[model samples]
Target: MNEMINRRKLLQAGGALIVTFSLPMARAATPAAEKTLSPARVDGFLAVAHDGTVTVYSGKVDLGTGVRTALTQIVADELDVPMNQVTIIEGDTALTPDQGTTSGSFSIQNGGMQLRRAAATARRALLRRAAAQMDRDISTLLIRNGVVTAAGGEGLPIGSLVEPTALALDIEKDAPQKAPGDYTVVGKPVRRLDIPDKVDGRFTFMQDFTVPGMLHGRVVRPSGFGATLVSYDESSIADIPGIVKIVRISNFLGVLAKSEWSAIKAAEQLKVTWSSWSDLPDQSKIWEHVRNTPVVHDDVTSRLGSSRAVLGAAPRKLRSTYDFAIHTHGSIGPSCAVATFTDGKLTCWTASQATHDLRKQLAAMLALSDADVRCVYVEGAGCYGRNGHEDAAADAALLARAAGTPVRVQWMRADEHGWDPKGPPTLLDMRAGVDPQGNLAAWESELFVPDGSATFVPLTGAELAGLNSLGKLSPGGVLNDLSIPYDIPNVTTTAHRLQSTPLRPAWIRSPGRLQNTFANESFLDEIAASIGADPLDIRLQHLEDARGKELLERLAKLSKWRERREPDRNAEVVTGRGLAYVKYELVRTYVGAVADVEINRKTGALAVKRFYVAHDCGQIINPDGLRNQIEGCVVQTVSRILKEEVTFDRSMVTSLDWASYPILTFPEIPEIVIDLIDRPQEVPWGGGEPTCAVVPSAIAGAVFEATGVRLRSVPFTPRKVLAVLRAS
Candidate 1:
């Protein structure tokens, strides 16, 4: 297909419409060929057609987070237009601007605001046109649902006032935006735009997308980490009916076939020898490795009084070390991508969250200019953070270039589990001192984490090919929430960035905030248990932020929290309630959670019976969408805290399937209650990740209350629980 036809096809497939318009309404229509979208211009974000349909272009994509609908709401409300008239196209390197990656829950907080401002600028420009056309004062014209009405009852549709071309207008920073009190759609519980098609399987995912004359490709990975391909016998796959070619660059080996099944068969049948290296540490001793690894530098995130001196002199002191295991994204459907190389230009259809960045990386890999590479986003399996999608795209680009044809690369389950970037292991040492009146006088924490340089997260296929890969590290955010949020008199927090880590690391959901909050909140609960105080009450005493205090108080009422009484350790089964709170990253969203857990002392099985959450994310865009995000956070994080861990031997990951790295099953999910505090007057934060930061700590507190054994480590496995019980 030609470029224009391809652009139209992409928009239609993504459930968006292509529209064009220019500013001032009276300007002559520019030739469609000459029109270009620029991020700095209002036209880049919004377009209007003769039919009055509004098409929005956003760089932030919706990875099943419902931002597609939430962003539409922001634009619809700001422009005084009906939601049905708005359509959003996202994450297309050629169409959308570079709004950065869609991680850290910034889609709504940052990206949404950009769209809102653009819409407001468009509205102002349109109103001026209407006033001039009707010979009326600007203040006398009112717009509602794309119709401008004057005081004399004369009205005009917005379509009649605009040219059918690019807006070509610069965005006005001080454009007047509709007051929140006047919003008719933004805060309402509107249904998500992409949900129905997804539910009925009508939506086209990246795996299902294809270009004409596409060959199926599968990469052959080594059996263990740090292994290099010595040689491959391609003749072994000659009998495979549809086997076309085998492409190998250095250690990167891949098979292309007429069909996907043939590619898979050929890949499995190809005989290959590889060089092995034992560089990974033992999984059991990973925490020890983290502690012993040389520190690149210690970052003092927060400091108050002299914590070391106060802790040394304090009458009562508590010290404990907590560690979180490595975790994979474990996307239900493995990553998939399609790439084509034509006329020395590359176009890739992928599911990467950062398409613009992927385009840059691919351009660099192929030694092409950025203008020659285009990355288009098609929704795939939900990956909360950076995963294998980008690597899969890289694989397709390489094979497509070699075969001189379009190639579709679909990662096998093993490829996904074995090679996807992992959430790096985190080890934390926490110390606190209690004052004479049972108040916390001092708090100190030291975090052992890897260098979270996202730019260095290497592409597996590129690295194997011996190309210019960024590096081996895939570290995620590791310094967020390093310091406790409570009002401790003497407090200090330090993060020791390790020069190296055992596995490829990448951000997963809440990233560093989740692990750091787990240690901080759980340690606070441990102190409360030691001093015979209610967990919720203790948090309330130290929390100085009004929003945080209100959130915790609301959580107590929601969960019907009661003071913890001494548990009967001799009982065969017991139940207890525990609380945790976090001001996400110590600045953004505020969340408080309470978990009710049931434990079988005999088998050491732990089940969360119920969970309650109180969330304050400043403003509400779509109540239903926000609730959905919060609920998803609670369920997924419960799995992480109770079962999810990337199991590995000395060389490579051993857990390659669901049977090995199990997740929280539907039957295991607990009943969840959520209360959202919406402040329309406040700026909207994010709903995607704040609630996740509290799940682990709340569950840990509940486990401690039930068994009176503080479970500092994550994924409190049955063996670990039983061992602690037997020793006690």
Candidate 2:
């Protein structure tokens, strides 16, 4: 069977309707050779059928962020169709345009806008056809519920205008879009499309997907990083039932079996010898290592007046150092993928956020043309950033090619927690000066961070197999918000890009903004405490952006923020509220947060009681979905700040299970209240990561208020808290 035809059949079998453009329509275009995946083409994004149902093709997959429904809302509103009449297909290399990775919360901001333009173009074309067919002026026709009607009540279904053909027109750069005030669906709190299937256990996650005659496979990783496989004894797993094949290429090793359990047993029982490597620095002194690492180059992100001169002339100056611990994606489910190679073409079903990029990587690893590889997206574990999904896809592809059959690879828990690329540790040094009148004078900050972003994180299986991979280290884009958002007399910020880090680095949500904002906002609070000023008041005084100031004020009103006074040192248990704000990336979304916390002086135990957030991302697509993202961001960031950390020795990671690396529990969740500010006339920004940037700083500020001890490091365990308390 033809691979493209086979893929369509598979999609149809999975309950999705696949519509193809007619030959006549394809031939009607000015350029007959125009690519089907062209982002500028209307047919690439939208397909209309005789039954009036519309199909939308998008390259950006939803990573459990509810973007699937949100994108649908954008299309429905712009195309004047019922939301239910539209269905979307996402992240198929052969089916959807390459909209790049679904990271940085750009799915709606970038990809949805592209689709919206395409939909608008299609709507315009359809309206023209309807006008010609009904002998009415185009301006006198209105589309409602996918039906074009004239002022005389004569109407035609949208499907009738484009039956047996495609919308072969190019997308108009200035296509007409529905006004915000006229929208009836885009901003509404429509229920998520994936929720019902997920709740009822009917959603087909990547782990549940399968191909005919597929074998179960599992990769065997080396004992530690940089370890080289010397030998493996296949006879060791001879007694294992259903063993199919043992694939060993260079340092890469894996086992295939007739069943999933058989693959697991065979992989675990197989004997392998490997050379050892212990180059990682001690975790206890990771901060020192980060500070001392050789600098590749200095990125002067922001510089205003002469900070050195102002600080020298100021009366009082304060300095503080802060660090964030390494973290894992901690996906609830392990990564999984299924792959098959037939007639020199490989097809893979994966949950990778960047399927198009994965397709290229897999093709390079296999030494095949890009056109010969196809990557299909299936919902799987929610990886907020790059995790093991792409690696698992590579593993499945390699094993499938070797075994001469379809193969499914599922990563074990240990594999996920121990081997997945980590969110690298971050260190920042902050300095601020206050004038004689107790006003801010100067501010300076320097960040010691990894040299690259997630774009450089290599494919694990390819790297292990001695195939093509980007041999560079990255901790995502942490350079964001290195420059503070506050308006000050003299300000300077620089990031010292480190040549090496303690572990293989990848992006884990908000990336650099989360870490930098933690330092920026918390240090602002430290300055406030030093000068006996209210945290909220100090932020408001320094902020100049109208939107940022409004967000802070709204946060105060929502949280019922009160001015702080001197702490009672004699109290046994103390309660305090702290404030933090961020203009994410210093330009995009704006967020303000308040954290209420309680602490026990005796045990040095801190408990967050509540969180109040004020968020403004310009325009709102789905208010309910935006709220869910903010709630999840708060919960997860709380986990990252209070509990999560990846432990490692010189040779390998030691935190391989939940007990070793704890996350926040359900019982520990705090009451969360959010006030969303909608600016309908302005362009929509990202909602996924903006709110997370404030979480750590807010919690840190709250911890400081509850106890006069500042938490300069993350994962504030009781031991660290107690040690700081005793030292204070």
Candidate 3:
């Protein structure tokens, strides 16, 4: 394995390639070789060897978050070295420490701090050693540009002292931590290190990974859920020239071929029959069953107030049922994995957010120790929590073990969309009780389809125990309002588990919060309209405390919510404004949106012209990245709200591709204005999921302002709008 490139060697007949090495000037008394060094090079006083090349490891990934640049700035600020000298390796299990996943928008909060502390510790050690050698106080020794110098003159570069010496220190438990005053770097935006490589097309993603003797693999999956591959007649593909071997496992059947194209071509030639349970149901029937289930995890799930009493005692109450159909992530790139098992060692290259979990799952499935399995992170095209790299990696490993060779399994875009674990269709029945004074008194909701509290994915004993003890199954955090951020006198929200197909329903951006907020916020807007109170004033009346107030204040200012007006433009076009609020964990984010829709009074074509969004996710890591995420969310939400839906004909999805299940294109994308407010960095909050929670509700509320009709169903397509208008 070459540590410089951070790639596993194929292990064939290849002569030794002359590797280049750069040695830094080492100071005396300090040993040259310290393998325990945690790539925590902040002051540039230390360097580690990776296949003879000096490299620096930063605990951040270029998950397109630009954390690599931010991390290098921290190193450059302390080390007094140029940015070019820093060669960063990211998210590699073999070369880098387990810095955890790059989701949750917490890379800088957690990973960035660890790297900074490590660097500070290393710098302190080097200066202390220099002071001991110079016979001066450790405080007098200042390090600048990879060298230690006395207060007056005469200095030595720390790199000059290179030997086998133990330089072990603990920076993990130091209290009080580093103050903001000591930070000369970290906060400043640094140039991204991955830009040049990406521009040059040299960055190696999972799609770019290729081995010298690797074979392409394709798995034959069951057509529907609970279906098993009864048998496969490979005799039909006997004439296919490049087809090499066929391996069948307990889960899936795989066919290996010489080329990726060839493997896919040969897979169609094989005859396969699948057998499913007799009582196979369709999407409509499945949703109907879900909407009528009883709440089981009430005590542990939702905690607002008693719904039965609130609904019965209220003088004025509004009750409506909202339905969200199943939708796939539809990531631009399909799921891919390449696994090689040779000489009792296993290495998997894939795009995964959960690397440690993937490694542990694969190791247990292969009956191998944790050390035998390694996962190499790759570039992800689009990961809205739908890249099931673990399944892909395990599938590849299973095929490789059967063939005794490395295999790369790649799913086609259609196959990925058809089999992708959807975000799970939800049925939300919400009831609100409002007093004559227009103040909210009671609120209640019944969440159908299991509340997404757990998943059925295969896991090891340790992983299962952790999930069980913590009670955090897949989308378990769906109870975003378990604490109830509003000041309603009495509130009750309970989750009911219903029997759906065995599809792994995980978090998709905001997940449960988005669905819940859309229902809650839109209904709140309706209640405000009914009471003749300003939407902004109504929200201000009950914003919990100070943090919620800050969000509402900033968002209202951005959208000018005080001067509200109903759409009275041309008869064919109308415009309106809407607001939504979301509080996930301890972070509070509010969004105010204004939308313009062009309606053809004759044709009934409703085209969204523009959407304005304002968000407050506290401290911003990269302002550009933050704004882009919010704008992207707006576009995706509009698309989903308008044309995205998985239509069902029988038991299978009919709208499987772009032709049927349409996404927003260039023409459909409206002008989006994103304003971010600086809440506070006292503790870094999340930006990724918070911004996503507002869009669906904003669009829904905006449409009501435009059409004077309530849309209770998702994917308010043009035809659906036409139907509503015609029925009126």
Candidate 4:
């Protein structure tokens, strides 16, 4: 896990850059092989018409993340064109390269970097042509405002120089990049391009999208996992106005209508009798369910020296268990997609994060080639991870392919909650021992979770429908962030994947890494308390990385270190501060957070008053974007810790509406402050998900500091807090 970036795919054509990697395997792979993998594609094309309007095409779409503006700024600055001249087209698979999904927070680091280098290469090609035409050396000329200049002798407009001939074809992997100080657009915070439309209500999300002759449709989902449709009476809805058709294959049932309300009303009246299944696990005993399952794979993720030997010689010891419950994405509205099947081709406009993957999966489902189907990304609800957006797309395609017409399918909110893939429940056991000096020891952790390969979270819609599935799983993240960064003598981390479970897990936000971080950081704080040491001080002592130390030290200052205090055993309302640190995937996105809380003694209610974070994600593409990502992480994580959980009965999911499943309210949000460390020389890293991994532990520490108690689980509700207090 070394620093991987600052990459350029070296080209013999004109020295254009692609992606830089620190992995030897990636480096050893040939250019053709790399293309076969996650190709660093420059799908963007610069078209300069006679009027000098520059249009750029990108494979990566903007998910309200302001990437359109950032990528536009990169191209404008690098190509020496006016910002106003650039228009970006994204997420149209037919016209763009396969840049893969916009997940993992790598859009800017991977997508924007390639676009920047591509524009730079285009500029170089323009200069080469200019140099040839003017009979002058390339270095002697300067470019400004999309025009090549030479000693005030001649000014050649880019529009005149482009096509009949294309400059991009001759451009390769290497090009002159602007130095940090010379950057005018890359580092600054520009206004987002998509915000104005959203504010004015002109923006159309998938829920509101309409096409000529498009029919509205709805699906009747199963009551529970393994449920089958026994019978359905379509004649019951025949009286409904504009009811076009009812399509059902196996358990999948859909109703299509000429009008939206007609479709919904008809579907509601179309009675579907579904057979139930009694095999689902009880929600109350999720931890037990996960632990009791047979192991599909059990292996130590990382080990250094023998932890058993070192801990056996220690003078003191402590052990703790942390459990995480199933949760949902909780989007503002139900998932929706629009699909058109015409002339043997299927086209879908969806909000899926992975369009290429969606296209491939849909093609496979329909028994068609990739060319016969296209998935175009459209703005939907802000999907944090694998939500039901893609599933809705599949529903639309399934119906549209059958109806042979344009169809828009939208799942009801209850249907969404009932079947959406959930974040897997986990039980983590941590054991460690402190030496005589209370400064050194051995550490070990065991993660009891769903089978690594069998339960590997699904990424596509086919997996959710149970018709098609991704066969294998990646080895990493089974116990990511479990490896201790502390300078310890012995440490061991093992992961046990459950052989089978009813739950279908998907990558929700940070996935298993966030759960693992919550456990490890909270347990570390517990260890500090047992050893009679301050949490911040203990971290500073063991963390040898300067970046980690810098984050902690900065957060400590921002949070006002002098104000934190020891836990008070007898206070009407307890108030205190606590700290936590994390590195995403163990080597990327270093983050530290300090949280302050006020806890009510009688009711055991907790309110986080403030949270401060220090982040080091290498280079700064957009300072405001980084701050927004950190702030979003803090708010969403606090919501997860305090109120959100997926609840289900033994045979069915009961948390089907907002009343059953809750999220953070506007009034409950706390003040979040962010500090960023920028190293422009290093490769830019992602700031999307990892910033959240530090939040739960920091909040837990703050609660413990306010009261003479410890929190091992999330959503430290009044009932749970009271139970812990009574037992203590």
What is the alpha-carbon lDDT of model 4 when measured against the actual structure?
0.75
Residues 161-185, candidate 1, lDDT per residue (tens digit)?
A: 8874435788889999988889999
Model 4 lDDT tens row, 1-728 = 22123112211111122222112322211222222122242324555555666766566777666777877887888887888888775665554566757767777778777777777777887888888888889998877888899985688887777663454353357788777777777778877777789899887777777665679988866666767779999889989999888887777788889988998898788888989777888767777777788898777888888899988888898889998777888777778888877667777888877777777777776677777776766777677777788778888988898888779888788867877677777789999989888765889999987665332234334443445534334222446776767787789999888776556666678777788888988988998999888898898999889889988888888877756556675878888787889978877889999988888888887888888889999888878777878888899889888877888877767888988888888888999888888998887888888888988888888888878688887777778888887777
Alpha-carbon local distance difference test for all models = 0.85, 0.86, 0.62, 0.75
Clashes of 4: 11
**Candidate 3 — what's its lDDT?**
0.62
Quote each prediction's TM-score.
0.96, 0.96, 0.85, 0.91
TM-score of 4: 0.91
TM-score ranking of the models: 2, 1, 4, 3
- Give the CA lDDT, 0 to 100, for residue 345 in model 3: 66
Instruction: Choose 1 or 4, whichever is better by TM-score.
Output: 1
RMSD in angstroms, candidate 3?
Answer: 5.9
Clashes of each: 4, 1, 14, 11
Q: For this target, which candidate reaches the highest lDDT against the unseen true structure? A: 2
**Cα-based RMSD of candidate 1:** 3.2
Score residue 717 of candidate 1 by CA lDDT.
79
